[model samples]
Target: MNNPYNLVRKYDIMLKDFQTISTSFLVKQLPTATLFVDMKLRVVYASDKLISLFCDEKVNFVGQSLFTIFPELDSKWETVLKECLTGKSSPMGVQSFTDAEGKEKFYEWSNASWYDSDENIIGAIIQINDISLAIESDVALDKANILLKQQSELSKIGIWEYDLQKKTVYWCAMTKTIHEVALDYVPDIDKAIDFYKKGHSRNAISMAVFEATDKGRPWSLKLQIVTAKGNEKWVLAAGKPIFEKGKIARIMGTFQDINEEVVAEIKTKDNAKLLKTLIDHLPLNVFIKDRDSKKILVNKSECDYLGVANANELIGKTDFDVYPFETAKLSRDEDLQILETLKPILGKESISVKKDGSETVFLSSKIPLLDEDGHATGIVGISLDISDLKQKEQELRNLINVTSLQNKKLINFAHIVSHNLRSHSANFSMLLDFLVHEKDEEEKVKIVNMLTQASDNLLETLENLNEVVTLSTNTQAKKEKVNLHTKISEIQQNLSEIIQNNKLKIINKVSQNIDIRIVPAYLDSILMNFITNGVKYKHPDREPQLEFSTEVIKDYTVLSISDNGIGIDLEKYGSKLFGMYKTFHTNKDSRGIGLYITKNQVEAMHGKIEVESELGEGTKFKVFFK
Candidate 1:
């Protein structure tokens, strides 16, 4: 086949006319870049625009192979040129390559295989149009689509589309996954419509579609739907009509699954309602104020206390609107302090002035309400009416002061009695000595017996006074971690003689690592008192057995002393078990002060003591310590 350039050369006889026509009409009028290639893919002709953009200098490019002129096109140039030379037409498609300046350029090119007069293939004409802007726009669009898909997946939302004209529905992959259906499921209009819940959802969507198509209106609504797996869900559906010549042609819309968010919103509303009900039923007056200190919400108790007819009347009102200026100012200041500090101010006293000019004192606890940012946005408070309790507390304080004065007088009187008893006992002993020296045998013997009984009575009174004084003193015991196993072992060794004499059996189950914070001396005294008491009150009919064990409860340790001996009737002596001078058994050694002292020691160390007993069954004393 002859090259098209050769034919054009034959037209060189009219080259000047052709050049004038090409420059005036063809070259100047073409908006696109144009080039002509011979069968060998050599550039035979190129527009002035193409020459200026690609070649720069026209003489450097003419008669050059197209690939040589633009070597960067080596990737796709051979295949495209071969197709064109063979008379096969290809659709216009985008091609990109870098220029001499290293800047990228994109073009959509279309080529036609030119033929000679004999209908044989010759050279080809190529038209090029710059599509860089369009390409960039398409790239941005693709990126946006990818980002949108990612965001939808992250938020657990899925989108769907439907075309009314084509009667076809399309679902994104996420949408199918949300409905628990297969990706290959081809949705029909009827099947898609049936997914909507029966009553309001179906009716609303039907109405929306009808209106969008019939009236060319747009609609957006939240509706419920049942998935293929029998799970209920919430969806946000929107639709708009596509018009052709002012007539509705198609309706398109998106469906988004918003089940989780919708359900959470509903639950939040329900919880708020329940909380309001609880606050209203509370005995204390509960109120909340906005940043401006205006009442935003108040419980029924507050409304009734302030003598307001309804809660609505309390809105936008401050305490000043309902109380005296002094009381209102005090309340407002407390609230302001709470807000400024962003902390709770508890047990502050305030007065509530009634509409009738009567006032009542209240113990109020106010706290700042913070937003998600940790900034205080308002205040919430509960005011407890404490007027009656306040009056009783004042009366008790007065009585205590009077009682303290009486106690001082009693201590002085007891000291005088002690002095008198000592002096009398001395005089009686001198009198008994005088009687013994008198040599009156019968009288001397009777006098000596009376002196002995008098001495015993005096000693008993002194011991009782000492016990009373110990009970009245407030002295805290020193605290340290005491290992239970070691302590028990030491106490058992100390009491080994008594244990052997009584043929007693002792069971120890205290763990070695079981340590508790307590006064070591006080613990030893407490344990001795418990063990001796058990032996002293042992059942006459059976051998004595005692169990010593320790366990931990919450933040404290419980050391239990259990005895299978004579047990007191807890129903009769429970309250007096730890009271001074209270004794259950009639044992001669029952001082009754042991339990009282043990209880005080435990309490001094911030601990507690309790007892459980059944007559003739056993007695257990549990001492709890830090």
Candidate 2:
């Protein structure tokens, strides 16, 4: 052999040189950011891409050490490169570092040793790739998957898949929890269908699945189900068939727990039905309208007033459909105003004239209906029939007018009668004086005496008649604020002697603050008459007692005078108790003129008198002052 060792060495040297030249050219033509390094970790050749990534410009970096070009490279990279130079292994992995600009960068390196023709170890070749964007993308994808899982759990939504080919099913964690099953529980198509409730629910879900798998149709339904713990629940199940090569491959969808929402909706509907029933039976004419002023709801009373057979006849109808043109226009205008102002029009009197010339009066009220956001939606109206009341009020006014005219005429007649009686009494008295002066015989003297007594009685009657005329003429008495307590006290003082003589007990329980609108003189006279009557009608069995009190009822202040005395038999003499000169007692001072005059005084002041009495019980007289 000419020299076997020398030939082997020479061949190895030539192979190394050729490998260097070809690898350098290949590195320069690589697509990614790649570079080749020698056994000493020095850059042998670098691609245009690598130079642009690590260097500011395309400078000569062929002879520079890898660490010198990238000074921030750590010891982990050195160890990887040195082990790759052994030619026993090729290490490929990613490494990260902060570059000169303080930006994080990732490099994917594939390092291996180059060999000669004799298979001897040579320098290493490192293909470095800038994988920063790919690394960041992978990190973001992982975070997104974690967040989606969390959101699905919180929303009570679970994903599921059914594989037709494998005849198997997959349930996410939330799906298992919804079914009240163990996390590791495995399910099949048949088993999944069994979870649905019997009858309607099971049939619905079965049909849905059949359509989805057979016809590639999608289904979303709210159905009931029974859990592993035997609890009934409402769930929203949705699914779609996945097609592959024009054939159904699998079914994938979501499952959600919707029990609370469905139950709430059912309860709300029940409440609405109850409210409708209640409103329909109301007696007053109640109605609800939409924004367009069309009737949406009406009660039976409303239908009756509109001349409809039933409430259905008036549905979706406007006022113009039921009422005359003028009446409908006025009602519509009021509805529009309430809607615009969001205010209520309460207790408004409306008059509707019929075609036959009859009129009906109604007290109507309208209020604005608002939505949850406080925006006006429509109006609610109520009307009450007041025609009968109005008619009665008019009739009362007419009667009052007629009574007033008659009273005036009666007062004028009393004045004329009293004047004529007074003149006749004066002439008769003069004739009686002449007879007394002319009489001398016994029979003449006796006749003259009787005539003189008759004349005296006639004069007394005329004087009392004058008093009545004077009081009747003052029908229009001026009213002023009078304190009841003070007037009662003065009357008591004026009648103190009579009160003491009969040992009468007069209790003034009237409130000091009780004031009434009445003529001052009339109050004094009324109090004086009541007090005197209480003393005059003293009972023989016991001591006389009088109680005075007051109360305010509605618009009237009532003064009550009660007495424990000999009472009148109202059933026997009630009608004529207050008649002129009527007396119920045998007492010498028993005169019914007091009550008659008291009633006249009260009526003149626009007040009234009510009496309650029994045969043996006490009497209560209530004076109502307006």
Best by TM-score: 2
lDDT of 1 by residue, 78-98 (tens): 787688889887744777878
Q: Which ten contiguous residues of candidate 2 have the minimum total lDDT?
A: 405-414
Stretches of model 2 off by over 4 angstroms after superposition: 1-23, 88-92, 96-107, 116-118, 130-137, 284-344, 350-626
Give RMSD (Å) of candidate 2 vs. truth: 20.3
Mark the 10 consecutive residues where model 1 has the least summed lDDT: 468-477
Candidate 2, residues 295-399: lDDT per residue as tens digits?
998987887776778778888988887777887888899988988899899999989765445678989899999999998898999888898889899878966
Q: All models: lDDT?
A: 0.81, 0.84
TM-score for each predicted model, relative to the true structure:
0.52, 0.54
Q: Against the true structure, what is every candidate's RMSD?
A: 24.7, 20.3
What's the distance in Å from true for residue 229, model 2? 2.3
